[model samples]
Target: MSRRVVRQSKFRHVFGQAAKADQTYEDIRVSKVTWDSSFCAVNPKFLAIIVEAGGGGAFIVLPLIKTGRVDKNYPLVTGHTAPVLDIDWCPHNDNVIASASDDTTVMVWQIPDYTPVRNITEPVITLEGHSKRVGILSWHPTARNVLLSAGGDNVIIIWNVGTGEVLLSLDEMHPDVIHSVCWNSNGSLLATTCKDKTLRIIDPRKSQVVAERARPHEGARPLRAVFTADGKLLSTGFSRMILLRRLKELALASPPGDAESLGVVCCDCMPTAQGNNFEEPVALQEMDTSNGVLLPFYDPDSSIVYLCGKGDSSIRYFEITDEPPFVHYLNTFSSKEPQRGMGFMPKRGLDVSKCEIARFYKLHERKCEPIVMTVPRKSDLFQDDLYPDTPGPEPALEADEWIAGQDAEPVLISLKDGYVPPKHRELRVTKRNILDVRPPSSGPRRSQSASDAPLSQQHTLETLLEEMKALRERVQAQEERITALENMLCELVDGTD
Candidate 1:
């Protein structure tokens, strides 16, 4: 028997334009994943929309603003010999962009500090490896210059943008065409949903997937998959065992429970496969999918993964937890206007001061609308209550290092403060100078930017006291860790003697 559900989501939608006018395109490919940006890379100054270029063999970048139409003088990146399938903005550099093409090549292009032209003829780097059309591309969440791409040949490759090299290629895992591939929070493990109806969790360093769940979904549909904030587990505390395992156990990783029972959902829309006696899939009544890829994006800091479908006009999000029914259904955000595509702004680009944790730019027939999701708070005041704790540590691999064959430190969320938006002046991407790859000096905590935030709030005694208290606690915690390590060392020494 399937269980019926009624969920009330906390998210509220507010639609506004990312540009000044209603931006329109000719047969915009919102039906497929295009990887266009809703906001600019450097300063959030412009919104990027992908359009079918000229006839059909290429894609053009349409830049818009809240003030005017696309600047004709602004250069359009045009190099693909075949139709461009998707594009991704570099997470670390606002000046950099990447596009995947049906010509079986991926091109990396750099935007000048100032350029005036309708199109650019060359790319900074061209990564050509796929035997068939390259269709998907994604940048690493934390690391710079690393990229992942999947193609029609049923293969995936991790690329190094700094040197333009193929760092790793995964070809033998999926029996059929690849549907979607996702990098967990820190880029340690990659989860792939494939036409074979299997979900594979990979240890990137080994070049082989150590675990997999067959037919995690019952429907014969292209689905999306992701690792929750905690590795492998879709939600925190979703299962008691998942929460209790040690970090090392998660590395070579023993799964917390039977893959069928813990990972697959027993949904009414999903039917059990031909010969498996797994636990029943969860009943997810909100999803209305007839076809196309259902891509999922997980925000580790917020513990939310939004699932968006290409054919469907609705987006359903779920909250991950440590507690079965580990993936709790949050409400679905629907619209009468179906989207051709969608773009999610990064955490740094969000307006957390207003308790805004997430922003999605949905492409309609005529305009790109910004949908803001926030936690409800009574005070207009900075709600530390709603934000994520401080960001976890950086990846162990440095820039230019190949992600393949190295064990990555799991991406974690350490609590201290939450998503604080970039300042308005800083956000004036159009009016600002390009940022250097690395600031001359950076620290654990950047003294907040000289934003328009009130000086009274900056100099408040309570603020100072709070800062000191947090610093002291961090120091004391470090000392305790050291003491424990020293004792372990001493015990080892005595045993040796």
Candidate 2:
């Protein structure tokens, strides 16, 4: 089931070098950063936005063209009433960026100008549905204007960005806060992870749950579940282990004639646990082994799956042995920090030799720095046309068609033909960045620089500054919300008073 095939950067250091095992350095300041796909509309140019965590509403839009001389102010995207929590670029539109925030709304902006072309602030759009804070927003992998957002209200709302309407609302499905939502490459399947220790797959069109895994992990706070390069599901949770399986496998495993049976496969994999110890009586000997939480990732070229253990900080690589039906562990990479979100470059024929490390950095603070690992672009697993193309996949073809039909000026692709090495210029990182935090149980003590404050401290400052600039708007929103709640409270008071 697995075959070997392959593949596949530079840097500037604003932070002084620390000279540790990994050439560790410190001092650069990055509030947030994300790894870009090699086919990223910007290509080779690592794209991400960084915010000043201390209270500034301004954000630095980075078009990291060259690692040696990264231009920080390429485009300063502004206009958020509060500190922005999440920022993502359109997979096919480099000039478009969407952000979710503590401002209780989501806004889509045209990059560079930071102009808000679309804003969801109406009572129904902002407050009527989600009673809690919105934590994340995810654009469909191949859909032009489709998006999915999960919030503190324990709901997932799929939105049609073009129409600015909620397509479907997934509520009462997850027992706890939903942390993340993602669409598979084909767009027919949507996966969600929740603090309820479950991962559910949904058919967004029908607004029904097709597949569900109960207690997918031992811990709550399921961080995220993502699709791999090969079109499998990887769920990561608080137990520090990622659950890996095939969507096809999951569907097939459902009851016959079940709605989930859409050519889905059935399978699963577990990370090997080391260090044998005393076994307690009455414990299932073979099954009671430590079920390390695995954050699954796929390497398309090698057709291998990497299981990152959040509990152990080690990556175990596996590959489907017989397609069964069988998956085999290949190799492993050990590191210090636990990885959060991970994905391979989406492109064909990428050179693997260029890949250096196992992960990338986002929102780093101390003088920004590129992740030591140079991830290779993920190649195509199956033929492009082989996938379920109901809603269509890949925007390139549609753009091409539009270009031919319309007399519009010649459209330029985000990436031109040529190989560009990954570079880092003006890279920023912070010692106390959230991504840099290692839980107390992770062992080593982390050192903090003067500006590297805890998230709580930064949150306090951000909240105060945000209240100052948008106090009127926020108070209005709160007053409306409180009025409704107060009416309910008054009714209760009258009933008891």
Candidate 3:
């Protein structure tokens, strides 16, 4: 007689619980833009969501503490001339956010701590290089002020937001639209999926595709890929399958078999020096047959990966291990209403005292709900096993250092005493003038014309002028206060005399 073996895992009993109704953000006008990008983004200090606007694109930024019904006329960060496709909060700075839009530009905004009375109509810096609408934005994992954007024109541009300059542009890699892009732990390599059914590992600094696997999934639908904690590639496609491959192996060997299997395929990209190749058999799991795409959010602390399907009312999480079944199913968090989009909070933002392992912001039709996942424990003491040193807001490397081929892991911070967000920090952008560079010896210098200035430059000038006017008003108010104080002092002295 054969006895069945049970899997022993700490996260096996983990459960997800939704916050109370009063804790949810209500009456939000979620955008109806028909795009694959997640409409919501959240950090420890604020929650941002793309909303429908009349003339152009806009997104509302609400303090995390403001939980009740949002005012319909709540001020928005509006500047994009078209619908905002994606927004990503900078990992190194909570107050900094980058947004991609249909206007073929990427704008970085500096969010203030206090809520603004009027809509913010200007961005700290606008990056314009893509010839088509930008659909994806991802910040460097360990570098400061470094951002990456993928556009519809089949181009990927790495930008240094500190100086508003293009660090590198990988325009020759993808022949079709890029579906998704993710950075590794050190931000030295990038894993991207494209519409041409290809998975590529790119080194932006080298401007080359180090490795690529064509048709990782034999489906017409788009594919999404991300870097695992161990520097492996985990990809999901519409063919109801997930593929895990080691990056080292991918760089050494070529994929041998066709990806026609309809289950989890673990390809051994790394082969031995003796030229021996071993392939793991496919493991199958029955998933929902809905057309909704699966968005996988991975937590490196717990080694848990949550799969949130668009337009689905359930979130399924799995634990990854080195055992036979690498991906083990934990449990599903179900709700009545389907989620339009989802925002995942970083590990540092979780409450360690409550044993909170992960938190998600689920976007509904008109509201946003918070779902907390915790590991039940009998003791109230800090669970060291549940909480590990996670990536904090401090950057490990600067943009220039990263561009110079330096790689560093993210700065880790302990959450044993609970994490406190830092005070509001400003993101300053210093733009370089093109006119400062002299003309080539073969070409004559031409007179600069105001009409020849780029729209972004003109906007920057207007923003500077506005700043000057505001400063003048502040000075005038100070002068008036001083004069009034002097008059009051003189009257008091006369009375005393």
Candidate 4:
């Protein structure tokens, strides 16, 4: 119940730390095994493997082909004594990646050589705060060198990556294991969903709870809560329940009595609205139940939440609206025919790209599985020239030249009116002939002029070169995206608990 304010110095430091996380990929490789779901990483030119369950971590690194195939032998990311639980690339440094493991430690590694840069042994700053196993770790979205870690002890800790310092520890709140911790867009608020069937909000800097509600999924299953793009409340929980719900402001239980405003009734003698006359109360209402869980991938581009059911392998997508209704069933890719631990590789249209899920990649019993989908790309769905009333490019434009030629001349014939204006007739004749005349010939056509021939050929060559340049750029972008998706798919395969 105690509320604390964050110091201004801490706020300035955290906010000023915002910068783009830089990732560079050079001399990196992907591991073999198309069907195996192993945790992976990529930044255009390189690929890194944190853990590969395939062949007992034997095929940890493979060379990624532009064709999306993995060729050649790759070594396991050495050093972790146990299976890595999660791996995250440093936002600004592609050379660095952070991983949490069952070994009760988090290690940050530099790619290529796969050397441990920071062991975080016993946690560089032991969140002695959490008495149980540390299960999850997430870096601040915009802040440089800031990380958030959650553990089995139902505690959350905020850390400074550069200094290896514990900035804040959040404990004594969640009743059960804290499944996840996410910061809002501005990093002012922290949203956590726990096994207690409640989603709680905290002001991270102050380490104090701003709001607490027991209205999340009721099954005691681990849940996830994330803020929407605008930092408004949007939470996913149980009972076919994904609630973008809000709490209502309550009316004060007791009416205040100002003695100055009271004419006759004495402050102590009036049948006062105090003590037993009133009771403190708090209530929450269930707005609506949204389906699916294991959290979801929030697509900021479309404002849609992609959710997969824990009970079944069904993937349901819902638009996060005023009440968040299920928009469509984004194709379901099932393993076990329909149940449990179904992982998803989140991207709107990645299933067809190189490294995309096709008939080629193989799937094993324990490895990660890939889900294929084809969604319209955001760029393709909208264009600057489009308006609601503007129809698509007019088909009639194709025959416009022919139509204009046929109607070019206006015939001026005699009008048998009682009164005919000579000037009017002349004006009509002049306008008609003006449009009917052929365009004046400037000179001999360029093809007939020999000296101009080289200029024409030069122009043609330049046009061809420009076209080729554009094509190369497009191909390169697609290749990079495919590499990124492959890495993401690998993580889905190997990092699952």
Candidate 1 overall Cα lDDT vs. reference?
A: 0.57
Q: Give TM per candidate.
A: 0.65, 0.52, 0.83, 0.48
**Candidate 3 residue-wise lDDT, 1-497, digit = tens:** 99998888889999999999999999998999989888999999999999989898999999999999999888899999999999999998899999999999999999999877568877899999999999999999999999999999999999999999999999999999999999988998888989998888888999988778776655566777777686656666655234532111111112223222223334431222321121222332345556676787888878887888889899988886544345677999999999999999998888887888999999998999999999999899999888888999999999999999899999999988999999999998877766556445565536466335655576787799789979977976796688689989999999999
Quantify how close model 4 is to the true structure by its C-alpha RMSD in Å.
Answer: 26.8
Ranked by TM-score, the better of candidates 1 and 4 is 1
Q: For candidate 2, report its TM-score.
A: 0.52
**What are the root-mean-square deviations of the candidates from the true structure over C-alphas?**
22.0, 21.2, 8.5, 26.8
lDDT of 1 by residue, 1-497 (tens): 99986544343332222332343322343223343222112223334555555543444454333323334334457788777777787655555678888889998876554442336656777888999988778887667578899999998998877766677888887788887777766676787777787767777668878677665554554556656555653311011123333110001112334343333334333333322222233323334323534556577766777766654577777665443344566667776776666777666566665667666777765445666676766676655445545343233465444453444543444223443322221111111112213345454544465432345554575578679969977976796688689989999999999
Q: lDDT of candidate 4?
A: 0.42
lDDT (CA) per prediction? 0.57, 0.44, 0.82, 0.42
In model 3, the clashing pairs are 249-269, 249-270
Q: If ranked by TM-score, best first, what sequence of candidates would result?
A: 3, 1, 2, 4
In model 4, the worst 10-residue window by lDDT is: 422-431
Q: Which wins on TM-score, candidate 2 or candidate 3? A: 3
lDDT score for residue 264 of model 4: 19
Off by over 4 Å in 4: 1-73, 113-131, 240-293, 310-312, 322-372, 376-497
For model 1, where is the 10-residue window of minimal lDDT? 245-254
Q: Model 1: how far is 351 from its true place, Å?
A: 1.1
